[model samples]
Target: MADLSSNAPPNQIWVAVKKQKVWIASGILLLLVAALSPDQARDSLGFVAQSLLTTAPYLLLSIGIAAWAVATGADNLIARAFTGSPVLMIFLAALAGGLSPFCSCGVIPLIAALLTMGVPLSAVMAFWLASPVMDPSMFLLTSGVLGFEFAIAKTLAAIGLGVAGGFIVMALAGSHILHDALRDGVGNGGCGAAKIRNPKTVVWRFWNHGDRVEKFGKEAFKTTLFLAQWLTLAFLLESLMLAYVPAETITSVLGGTGIGPIAIATVVGVPAYLNGYAALPLISGLMEQGMAQGAGLAFLVAGGVTSLPAAIAVWALVKPRVFTLYIAISLGGAFMIGLAYQGWTLI
Candidate 1:
């Protein structure tokens, strides 16, 4: 018989490394330990399960919204509309993003595509910052998990920051920064190219167009593929967070006394890039343990906005200066909002 260990494939060599084996073995051991310690495992598992559950509704809503936006060609129309007037574009972009239910990852690709189609950088930035926080899915989750008052507060805070940040970016960078990167005539292409029928003439097209079934099938396939690619990275990040971070750590850092908690929470959250679903349990736990509302809100905004994947994606697509500006704007906005929440509560 062939020597099984000696004949292992090259790919399996890395997996057989002592360090890797030890790490894997240690992980299994830790899991067993946690399982034996029912109370600790229960708390940790509960936190992760709750996080997943809270995020599920928002994920579904966001995917549906994104699919509709793509299928109806609303994305292109909105980009074109914004190109006409910079100020109007900023407001409309934020409004559209705020109302839609897309998470940060789901929205990033769409925003990147829009930028590639020549949408204003300021408007794109506003949408990036606002969408995850103000979207209906987030609103529903926030209200469901926290309460209506907290949801309303979050919505208003996100909008205010989005608008203000858009204006600031526009003033500093100029609209030209975005137009230079976009594909030529991206928005100007007629909807006919995509075989999109006018909403008013949908009935007529259904009756007249013999290939309507084929066209519908094509649209569905494209939308599904687009959504799958969009969500893949985000889902991976959520899984990692669920697997690694401890609930007590989240609660302690975010719930500590004074501005220190807010600062620590912001620092921890800014780099995480988790969706509200992955973040909900952590935030709820902090709140339940007497973490300041303002700090928890800050963590949510920071985590929602500045994901590492989105940052890397942005960096690859835009100029270094532009990408740096994007990160700064998001961080600054989160800090300001957190500060405002703190101030309001103090008053």
Candidate 2:
């Protein structure tokens, strides 16, 4: 007989012994126990509902914006426009990213496309940091959920950090590093190699290429599939955090004198993943339970900046050192902003 242990796919092997069914049964039993145990079930249910509420709007916005970018090829155009000065390019890229509706995951592919199209690394880095925080959808969500003041503060902070970080990276690393990092893939001979195709012709070809609705449907499906896997994992993690981690735990750990809250919040947030929309309810809960504003803001920024999917995408494109610098700049910038916001609030 074949070596069934080695040959069997994990899923198949698990199912062969009914382990999958057993696991599901055990999970249901535990859920039932949790439900019957105390008020924890009710709290967990409330948390889950709140989490969904906070996340849904941002999720919709991300999908819509991603679809729009793919359909119109606006992402490429913006990246192409930023090829002049690395510093200026970074600012423009960050600005564009801030305005666009792509989430951290969507931003990664878009930035990759931009870099592949010859956009500077500084610009790409700026976009990576800015897009999640500055996008219109996220801004609107923040305003609706967190109020106008916080929304404005978040937007300004995102833009400031993006610009400052980009400039710092450019200054420290120099333009040559960006050029060299991009040399192998983003050189002149790559995507930009095609002679300037006529704009009108391109438009006509796109319109004429297959059934427009069908083409759009296909693209949307592909994009959704790509996002669903990552987003689902993020959502699952969010649920786990809500279910198990008490608000008081976070407050107790992070809530303290002077920028300590900000530091703790930022640290907690670095590993967490959630759309700003999804995070609002959690933040509100934390705030209600004594989490400081600055700390909350820190969490928001950290989550936005250090998403797993975005980091993976960046790693694929740039050198490890460059990627590390991007993360460091983003985290430090977020920490400073969070601290400033908290300080201003106290003053």
Candidate 3:
């Protein structure tokens, strides 16, 4: 009775529009194509629709696993990665981080919890570095877009980068340079800390618990929306690029098998990278255009670890010097891995 509509948050329709902006943008692009070139528009629609259906299985599997981790409270089990010897901890942390399906935003609170609890920086570094690069979903999607061999290679790269970063921090532990790395005034992950500090028993039978079942539904919906929005935008862009961008241009700029293209790809990746899922189809397109295999791999690795959001998160938690070290390791490791992968391709 008190003009309740006036005080209500922006119209639900508008709120939804904002949330689904990427899809909207994609829709607009299709409309323009329909106006300018009706034939191509039909082909584009077919390509996008068919591509989505083809990848549907992979997306469903990834979403289920990710939601299961959340609903079962298995995400809180990251503490297990730190329980062994320093060297062993590094290995497990790296491997677990690579396999875990935690999103960038979700990983933040957990990392805060880990550092505040005095988890050794070496192992923490390992976990942090690897977590962004690969996860079960990423592996499946990459396999769908790229190939099994490349997906397998990227998984190894994630673990390898994590191990190298961890050991480097371990060696530097004596200097105490990175000691107490967190910036002042950061909350100890707030409510998120409790889950890590005292992990709850994971109920794999999440359907039995009303709360967990609800959580799974919400998480699955969220993940599905996230993947669909980004993938739709990606496939849209892919259609346009294939329609307009010349193979000669992509080939001349990014083609060839050598250190040069790989290095260039790594550098460009820092800026041009879309989110992990969105990047796959674009890289696949470039490869079809003669982009070097090593370059593609380097771009994926570099982008995964050094994207702006990832960098900002690391910078916020640690001192500038520690941030610098993270960047150095990420870039250097990406380059070296690219070279190694290039050599392997030749063999």
lDDT comparing candidate 1 with the true structure: 0.60
Q: Any residue pairs clashing in model 2, and if so which? A: 54-277, 54-278, 55-278
lDDT of each: 0.60, 0.64, 0.86
User: How many clashing residue pairs, candidate 3?
Assistant: 0
- Stretches of model 3 off by over 4 angstroms after superposition: 1-17, 174-180
Q: How close is candidate 1 to the true structure, as a TM-score?
A: 0.63
- Model 2 regions lying over 4 Å from their true place: 1-39, 46-77, 80-83, 103-118, 174-179, 182-250, 274-277
lDDT by residue (181-209, candidate 1, tens digit) is 44333343233223212222223233244
Residue-level lDDT of model 2, residues 118-156, one tens digit each, is 555667677778766667656765765567798888888
Best by lDDT: 3
> TM-score: which is higher, 1 or 2?
2
Indicate the worst ten consecutive residues by lDDT in candidate 2.
195-204
- TM-score for candidate 2: 0.69
Model 2 Cα shift for residue 308 (angstroms): 0.5
Using all chains and alpha carbons, the TM-scores for the candidates as numbered come to: 0.63, 0.69, 0.92
Model 2 clashing-pair count: 3
